[model samples]
Target: RLRAGVVMLIDLLSSVPSVVFGLWGILVVAPAITGVYTNISSALSGVPVLRTVFSGAPISGRSFFTAGLILAIMITPIITSITRETFATVPRAQKDAAYALGATNWEMIRGSVLPFSRSGIVAGVLLGFGRAIGETIAVALVIGSSPQITQRLFSSGDALSAVIANQFGESTGTYQAALIGMGVLLFVITLVISAFARAMIARAERRIGAESV
Candidate 1:
């Protein structure tokens, strides 16, 4: 019953509209995290390589960090569902054999379950990344919608999807074409990432098969 309830909750979260999450991120999350963002920005402003990344002084929470956090939250349910299903598919016989070999619970999971599920986990993570890349409204709200590039993580910057979504309506002529071009670029990038993910999954499977043999 508890497991069923948990599954139901994840399903509900995954099914909730992306726009709703965007509103929540902007209204609640952005305000709440502003102080933390400011502090981090201040602390890391003088570090070596990181100083560049955290160079900007952030007055508010809307930034790459905030957008990324929201994206992670949005994708968590999907990833969790996939991971749960993947773990459930691990063979009972394999687990029993590991236990029979005097493997502790942690050791059994590390050696048997993890190896068996590694490919599935990789696929799940990549799927989450794909979802995140395509996400628009939510990311745009939290990402500050600035087009300029900077080393600062706390600075407002535009993602390809966010820029297209925000400007595509008012844009005309070459500007409109450029936004459409960005859409094409986004599609090609996603396609490449998906192909890369498939390759990675295949490589993991081959390595796992070799280890099992």
Candidate 2:
């Protein structure tokens, strides 16, 4: 019953409009976290490698860091729901066998349940990452829309999707073609990542098969 309830709730949350998430991130989440981002950037200023990545104005939290954080939050429910279903599908006998061998609850989960669900979890995470990549409204609102490359994570920045969504209406000729090209690039990248994920899943399945043998 609890599991069913969780599934329903997650479904409802995932169905909410993207623009709503954008409004919330910009109006509520961004204002709340601006100071935190600033302080973190300042605190990391002296660190070697991290200093370069973390040093920035933060500019009231409309930044790469904020956009990424918001997107992660938005897609989390989808990933969690998929992962929960994957975990729930594990065989009862496998868990019992682990316990019968005197395994702790955590150990049983690690040795039995996770191995079975590993591929499913990876697929779920990939789905979430893909969703994040295509997200536009929320990202556009919180990403500050700056078009530049920088090591500073807190710097204002925009993603390919955000750029396309924000500019496609006014773009013309070469500008429009460039935006379309970005979409193509994103699609190719996603395909490559998916293929790599498939390979990883296949390798893991083979390893598990060998262990069982």
Candidate 3:
């Protein structure tokens, strides 16, 4: 019952519109994390390498870190679901074989399931990555939509999707062209990543088939 409820919750979250998530992040989660963000900013202020990364105008909860956190949350269910389904598809015989070899439960999983499911895991992760890269409204809202190149996780920075979404309306000829170019780049990158993931999944399926035969 608990597992079913959790799965149902995940399904609902996955189905929510990106704009709604953005609003929730901006209104609720971002403010809630402000104190934590401030502490992190202060701690990183003195470090050498990290100081540079964390250096920015001011620490804000609605920053790169927050955007990343939101994206992670949004993608979690997708990756988790895919990985769970992939593991579920693993043959009982392989697990039995591992146990017959005196493997413990964890060892059996490590020796059999994981090896067979690695490609699916990679594919799921890549799918999540692609989703994150293309995310526009949610990322734009939480990332503060600033056009800066700071490495500070707590600093406002721009992503291609965010920039295009926020500026396309008011942008002029050159700026609009640039934004289009960015969009094209994002599309090409996503395409390549998806193709790679598909290839990995296919390879895994072929391997499984051969082993089964």
Best by lDDT: 3
Ranking by TM-score: 3, 1, 2
lDDT of 3 by residue, 79-100 (tens): 8888887898799999999999
Between candidates 1 and 2, the lDDT winner? 1
The order by descending lDDT is 3, 1, 2
Query: lDDT of each structure?
Result: 0.84, 0.83, 0.87
Tens digits of per-residue lDDT, candidate 2, 125-148, equal 887887888888899999899989
2 or 3, greater by TM-score: 3
Candidate 1 residue-wise lDDT, 1-213, digit = tens: 999998899889999899999999889998898888768767876778887786664556788888999999899897888678668767688999999999999999999999888877888788789889989999988899887988778788889999998899999999999999999988988888778767866776676567567
**Best-performing candidate as measured by TM-score:** 3
Off by over 4 Å in 2: 1-9, 191-213
TM-score pick, better of 1 and 2: 1
What TM-score does candidate 1 get on C-alpha atoms?
Answer: 0.87
The clash count of every prediction, one per candidate, is: 0, 0, 0
